[model samples]
Target chain A: MLEQYRICQTTGLRVFQSTENLIKANAVVAVIFLAIGGLFGLSIALTRWKAVHLLPADWFYLALTAHGLDVLVVWIVFFEIAVLYFASSVILGCRIATPRWAWAAFALMLIGALVTNVAVLMGNSSVMFTSYVPLKADPSFYVGIILFAVGTLIACFVFFGTLVIAKQEKTYEGSVPLVTFGATVAAIIAVFTLASGAIILIPTLLWSMGYISHIDTLMYRTVWWGFGHSSQQINVAAHISIWYLISAVVLGAKPLSEKVSRFAFLLYVLFLQLASAHHLLVDPGISSTWKVFNTSYAIYLAVLGSMIHGLTVPGQIEAAQRKKGYNNGMFEWLRKAPWGNPAFSGMFISLILFGFLGGISGVVMGVEQINLIIHNTIYVPGHFHATVVAGTTLAFMAVTYLLVPLIFRRALILPGWAKAQPYLFGLGVAGISVFMMGAGTLGVPRRHWDISQADAILPYDFPGAANLMMGLNGMSAILAALGGFMFIVVVVGSILFGKKIDASTEVPIAPPEDARVVGEYGNEDHPAIPGTIALVGVFFVSFILYYFVNWKYLAEVWPLR
Target chain B: MSVSPPQQKIWWNEPVPKSELIWVIIAFIWGLIMFFAMVWWHIYGEQNLSNESYRITAEDFSAKTEAMVEKYKVREESGYPVVHPPPGEDIYLIARLWQWWPILELEKGQSYRLHLSSLDWMHGFSLQPVNINVQVHPDYEMVLTITPDSAGEFGIICNEYCGIGHHLMLGRMYVVDERGN
Candidate 1:
């Protein structure tokens, strides 16, 4: 099996045949789920639109539950597993340890995902993602999630095993690549996240089966968010790693200061999971001290970590572009960047949108007082759509374009559509996020199948603006669905029907110009990243502006006595 | 045919540039500032949820809420309890599957202790237009004081996903003048 492994000509990284197969399998499954989840998403969006109100109440909740699980847990985690294999075995040139075990994990995950989906579709498990106890679902729903988490837990262990094997095999000298280190952080956090899920979910599963008498709702929320919000922390770490990887692969970008970058990753490991407490900020039975501690003091350290990455990713790209002599004025390097390449353009857009939309709103929503207004509103979803969909999903989609030629050994089928996919998806998602948040600020309730509440005993009305915003959210969802459709077509077509190529013989799918593939990570320390410095200033201004705007909004509400 | 990752020393722990350190420090300061600002708001500013919640059995709480509603029962409108207890009195609100009970009628500018609890699943007290929201869970009575600054009919929408009729879980709060219009 080791003999079957070959060096990727495009990336010059080792690719174990078995590991490649696993990665391909996981990536395909992820895409399938993305399609399924995207369909459910479109239905929910239309249903909430008030004008269209697509699905009836029962189907709406069912779709919403499926949408949450498939997209948030299944799709992203599957892709992250692929990413883990790629980062570990492939990047470090080590054969994946226990390939048989990896397959078992994959099988477990697939079966678990299907079981959960079937349960939801069967109409017994419309309990939604945060299946708060007492409002019980089918036992199989909890069991499915448990099985999936256990499978992922094993996959994470496999990833760690690959790292240890690489170390013992002496595949590379010194520390692992920054991207690998970041993945390691994600893997470590995933252990904690999965464990939390198991801790609460096992009992909940028992409760669903009448084995347990009761589960405390508050305790359930506390621990559930430990699983729920921290899952996104996994995304944060994984997607940010991809950010580093993309900049390097696409532009030969080196971090401005590798030590500073590593420190940020360290900060993530130390503090990121604590931000999960933001979910319980407005919950009863928790102390103000705990809420304040989690939301403010400790959480800020995590925010700092993200802020550092927000600066350094673009900083690295600017440094690389300047080295290539695009260093005229401030943003000439940005302007001259390969806008046509989906990989670079997509990653860059993910970074920017994630920062401005997701990052800003997240901090505001986490603030204890500020959260009172937006907690459980559509604003909550709005913030996450920016982070998860626009940020992580977009990054994953972008990387898939790169993975096609490198791993699948096939050219992208529709290069033009691939090029347009990022902008369309990003723009539409941005619209969805902005419009939803706008509606939420206007006091539009979330998770409502009918925003009009037409069948209610007593008729009440939302401001006309809320209706308009929901209508726009529907329109944006259509645009996003189109983008999602194009992506599926491109990915599926490329994999199954596009022109196959020997990547070694031919230049693999528009390799980065003057590919300055550095011999070592952090070896190419440049003198200046001045353009990045300017950009960070702009980001700071935006962050301050958004933060104050929320405060102003909060203040405008009737003063608390 | 060769497949080997290259030996590369000093991958991490490289010397940080002065500029990067400066930005990190600046971020830390900004964060510190925000943290302190929140503390100030919680303490002195007009943004504090009443720190007056107590754990209770869902049954016990609901029974107490029923007694309170019966005591303050001003009228029965549309098969729902409408209560207007005295000013500054403890006001009881029950969140069930699809409604917040006892349409509250409060006097404007008179502080009232608004006690909220859920009888079944979790619900959210999202007082719209005013835009104050809090999660109302079973087994805990969440108490928040409110003196309505502007008198009007404020709709209370359950923001938390309860069930199929979570959307229809709407309650109204009428804050009229002292004359009880």
Candidate 2:
């Protein structure tokens, strides 16, 4: 009788009341913010394509500002938070830590998002979102940043509190659950992320308040990016964790090298703290040696983590299929795996595309000599689109389609379209990225509203090789925009109107005593193999958003016109 | 709680077995190889480490536009004279927050290396089509060398967002392959 009560409107997550439904509802809300960022991607491309830099100087800076904060910072981080919550609360079999606090965090973030959006739209925070002074903006913009950071910090505290409780209760022991492990690592990184924010936001606020005499532009840029770059790694770890969850959700498969994967995630936590220095490689204030080491060693370590996953995830997939008795040729496992499983297939395709273009391009962009050509150019944007926008964010979107309904006991609405969105964004962003690479080769700089009049090298008159590429970037954004709209519909519809199903009995609904170590449950026959893995699906991470600055990634000549 | 309790001792929690000690050693050795390889390329890598240096509007293009602006109400900090071509330099190169002019200029026979850089927010000093660029922080030093083998006007553009005027940051270098005496 008690089990049956779990299925009713009073207790079950029938769209809204239950924690599961509430969590999915929050995810849908966050997606709206990400969509705006996605749209800005196209706007930027079009601005460059027409060589118009089109929006008025102020409006252009506003859009550029929103594009950076909204898309780059907010989109990925919020999505990561949502997914992390779902993984911890439902997937790991725990009640969300203080459902009220979670809602408060959401409210604070939502309000912050609104305030910042309005401020930017009104041209109050047009300092390119970097808060680099000499370029001033209204005070509200700085306030908005502070509020947002506060909300995020509160969310982190809430997450940490729950994990501590989970560990003390000893729900399970030995090794932490792989998804939880990955999340814990991301939370660990959040300590640095919040610390870095305090470093940047506090000073910026001081400057905004006129409480400080000066905010040295060079020092500010360096420290800000330290916070900036490391946060991306957080996005990365979470995305990988989701991939692990996705494989389990769809295929009942676990990772190939449990120890190796967990170690790699921990590497991100230990190393990425200092890797933020890579963003300042070209800045003159820092020494060349510092730049070289930070770029090559620090950033590369994180990049190596991606490389490992790139190789390992597929290897596990292959091995799993093989174990399942698909004894065909080398590529047969690829064909045999369920492409129809939205999370698994979508994440797989996103991975392949990002590996060559986003990952390697990011590595190249971080190099001392190579950073010169690409920094702050369309190429800079292109590189990141592949990484953050295309790579991390897309993974999350895909995973959400599967996890959301499952958590809420709602059947997916338009599961077919849910599957299609990934391919669309992947293709569109690919086109955009290639176009940006061409522009980088041709020398088109980023962050300009219009290039049309008598301009400089990437002159409004003639953009050279980048001319065609910029236009192509616009087309890519447009295509991706369409895909983004479809994503909104599918995700929102799944949570709101889809038919309801009972949360699986096989799937645990209560928070386990321990989530630190992952092991199989039930039956010695299968023994769940004590299978430990971190293969993920539906983790939405983004590459394009990270490229919003283009300043660190590109370099331009002195004013020519 | 309807959910089954998690199993004990997951694979990830297990300590490395003795058999894998050799693998760790091999991994260490491989890491050393990779690190050294990158260092070798970095310290003495074969790249287009060569470039040419020339100023735009080098007294030669000295368009009277130099007088285009009203006489300064005051002298700038350099005190090099509120004069157009500051003493000791034959060029009146005017670069705004984000762009440069006359991207190319060179003597046909004279071999020269351009010391390129920025004077503000990290600007990109790049020669398009070739991966020759670097960040030019204001108060930072930059050195670029280019040996123009032939006579021609090459395009130069800023690839960084020094400011809103970033896209217009363009410069040129014309190699007078053989500057007649």
Best by lDDT: 1
Lowest lDDT block of 10, candidate 1 chain B: B1-10
Q: How far is A43's C-alpha from truth in model 2 (Å)?
A: 1.9
**TM-score of the A chain in model 2:** 0.85
Give TM per candidate.
0.97, 0.80
Task: TM-score for candidate 1, please give it.
Answer: 0.97
On the 0 to 100 scale, the lDDT of residue A62 in model 1 is: 93
lDDT tens digits by residue: candidate 1, A402-512: 888888888889899999999999999999999999988978878777767777665578899999999998999999999999999999999999788675464744356
- Write down the worst ten-residue block by lDDT for model 2 chain A: A525-534
Q: Compared with the true structure, what per-residue lDDT tens digits does model 1 show for residues B39-131?
A: 888877786776678988778888887888888878877788888889989888999989888788888878888888998889988997889
TM-score of chain A of each: 0.97, 0.85
Error of 2 at A199 (Å): 0.6
DockQ of 1: 0.50
Worst 10 residues of 1 chain A by lDDT: A516-525
- What DockQ does candidate 2 score? 0.21
